[model samples]
Target: MNSISSRTFWVSLAVAFGVTLYVTSSVLAPFLIGVAIAYMLDPLCERLDRIGVPRWAAAGAVLFGFFSTLTAVSYFLIPFVWGQLVDLVKHLPEIRTALMSYLQPALDAGKPHISPMVIERVQEIANISTGTIVSGANKIVKGAVTGGLAVMDVSVIFVLSPIVGFYLLKDWPELSSFITDSLPRAYEKKILALARAIDQTLAAWLRGQMVLCLVLACFYMVALTLSGLKFSLLIGLLTGLCAFIPFVGFAIGLTAALVAAAFSFDTWTGWACVGFIFAIGQMLESYVLTPRLIGQSVGLHEVWVMFALMAGGAVLGFTGVLLAVPTAAILRVLLKSAYGSYLESDYYTK
Candidate 1:
């Protein structure tokens, strides 16, 4: 195909794929999740195979470790997190009361400087916002539980993901080779090179992000618990999970921790401790952990990543989010290659 035609064909194919994924999102979530899991674990499976383990055995081991970890989290951690959520919901009124008590004095002091109309409007808005927030929060929590249960009852994600992951991991080599073989002979080398680049980029990001999440979770959990914060475990784990989304995780975690501290601790010292804990965590992540673990040269920019995540979530919900990074990585590789080719062509050289 001519270059323009080729580009058009690929773009059309991508759009079609995206539309199909969106249409079948409800059913595709499990399969997509399984594919992601398998992709991440395939390297380890290959490593084990290299070290004389059978592919099936390696796949099984990975699955076993995964499920064992899941079991532990489900038994020990989930209950505590659930309790904290329920407690937070129950105490929303108290939280609002305390917040208002703290802010009211300032409002009163500024009354002389501020118009009575403005004060009344502010008060009215605050009350409305607080009511909406509390009611919405309560509804969201209940709806989340109901929605999760409904999904589990209807979808095969819980049951099928592991099975799919296991088979994909086991057959990874053959599957990969088949893809390569199916490619046009002239494009094989370039396509394979692009695939390798995409794999390397994704592997580094995903693996590093996972490690970062775990370490941050442990640090936050321990520090907050030691600092005597309420619901520290839940807040800490949640923050860690959010860390994958760049700034969003840190902002959410910090806000949650601060609110909890504001309610639980009577002294300024407790507040200071919470601040110190998060400050140190942020510094460590930005300066040490990320630089060393995630490396300095991930090709995708933060804005691009944030955009991809938002776009994915908007279009495909959870499945889009799962596929976002890899898709971004693939497109980056392809675009870079195309740009390089363009730079070398007569149009650019002239």
Candidate 2:
């Protein structure tokens, strides 16, 4: 086939794949999660294999360790989070009273013309209730049911992940060789170089971000706990997790901490402490955690990162969010290549 025809065919194929992906996204979440787990464990499995462990055994060991760690975390963290949530719910009346007291003066001063009935109705609707709790529980149950369905649909992927991982680990070297062998000899070196660059970028980003999250979580927990904040563990864990979403995590965490602190202490001192803790966390993240962990890897702008996250969330919900950064990294590589080609073209020179 002519070059033009080949290009057209590849472009059409890509479009078809994208369409299929979008349509099948609901069932794709588990498979994507499995793939992410496999990808993260692949290096460890390879290292074990290199030291004379069989590929299957290495894969099994890595999978076991991974799941064990997850189980341990869930055991401790889940209950902590649950308790915090229950406590927060139980104290809703006090929180509402505190908020009303804080806001009433401002409302009165700012909007004298506003009707008291309208304000009271707004407050009543906003008030936390048993019905709200029940509604939340119902939503959780519905979500769990849907999640169960998705799990059942993707059961094969979950069951097969370790199996697939074993072979992939064993054959990784051979697979790379096979791909390189199949590529056009003229472009083989270039393709390999590009692949290595992409791999390095992705690996650095993943490992660095994870470490940053953990460190930030610890910092948050210590600071908030010292500040006498209620639900410190839950807030800290959430703040750290959300930290991955750029500023959104810190903002949510700070607001939640401030509210909790205010309710707990009923004074500006608590609010001041809340602010100080977050300021320290932010300072550490900006000056210490990010610089030390991420370094100069994956140079995408914060705006672009935010856009990618939002786009991914819109496209595929949580799974999309998980995949967003890696996908953006790959796109960055492709864009860099295209730009380089354009720069070298005769039309550009003219």
Candidate 3:
């Protein structure tokens, strides 16, 4: 083929790929989530295979167990969460009242020093923040359950995701090999080494993060329940699950927990206990769980991960958000390789 024609063909393929993603973005969430599930389960599948389980059977076993647990949770756990959400929404006024009760003493004490304008602004900020927190949560959860788009997405997750995951899990090795084989010969060896490193490290990191989240969730649930938190189960689970989102999850969970604490407790000690639970959770994650599970670094910074997620969601909806981190990690790896080459070149030697 002529060089120009070849260039056109490649460009056309890229355009087609982008167009396809845009067209199918609405339905891509379940499929993308399935892909992630398959990737995460690949190690387990491999382990089962090594112990005399056929690859297909191993894939089936793992996927079945996972989806079964997920289905059970959707059936039983979700309704409980919904109930907590409803109760939380109902208690929002009390949370605000309690918050003001605590704030009023300080406001009165500083009334002469703090202008009325400042006091008004402070009250407005607190009201809006708390109101937005629960209201936003209510809207998102309800929309996911009842929205027209939600039906299709949720159905796909139930019916289609397992099938997608099964095939991907079973074919993982061949798929990896095929990708490596498709690279150009000139730098194939160099790239293959980098690819393998990326594959191992990235996979380990993702799997570790999943484990970390689960561990944190269980810990929070138990700890909060013991502390007599009114919505201990709800707060603990939220805190645990959200642990994966860097600071955002912790912030949402902590804010909710603190509000619940203020409303539920008469004593400052109960309030302090609730605050310490979150403080301990954060410290545990930073000093212990993260270091042991995901190592000290995973190439992608917190800011970059947040940016990628936001940008991806903005561009491609839920599917984009799901893929953003892995895609960013891959690009960072490649860029690092290019940087190394540049340093060795005469251009850099000068």
| lDDT tens digits by residue: candidate 3, 253-306 | 898788788888899899899889889999999899988888855666777777
Off by over 4 Å in 3: 1-16, 71-79, 124-152
Candidate 1 structure quality by residue, lDDT tens digits, 98-133: 767767898899999999999999888888877787
TM-score of each: 0.92, 0.85, 0.87
Superposed by TM-score, candidate 1 places the C-alpha of residue 44 at a distance from the truth, in angstroms, of 1.9
lDDT by residue (tens digit), candidate 2, 1-350: 78999899889989998899888876676566666677778899779877999877887788888878877988977887777776776676676677667766766675667788877765666555434744675566456447876567567666766566556665666777898898877778888888887788777777788889988988888888888889898899889988888899999899878767768786788888888889988998889888777776677656777889999999888768877988888888878888999999997999
Give Cα distance to truth, residue 55, candidate 3, Å. 3.0
In model 3, pairs of residues that clash are none
Candidates' lDDT values, in order? Answer: 0.87, 0.78, 0.83
Candidate achieving higher TM-score, 1 or 3:
1
Clashing residue pairs, backbone N/CA/C < 3 A, model 2: none
Where is the poorest 10-residue window by lDDT in model 2?
125-134
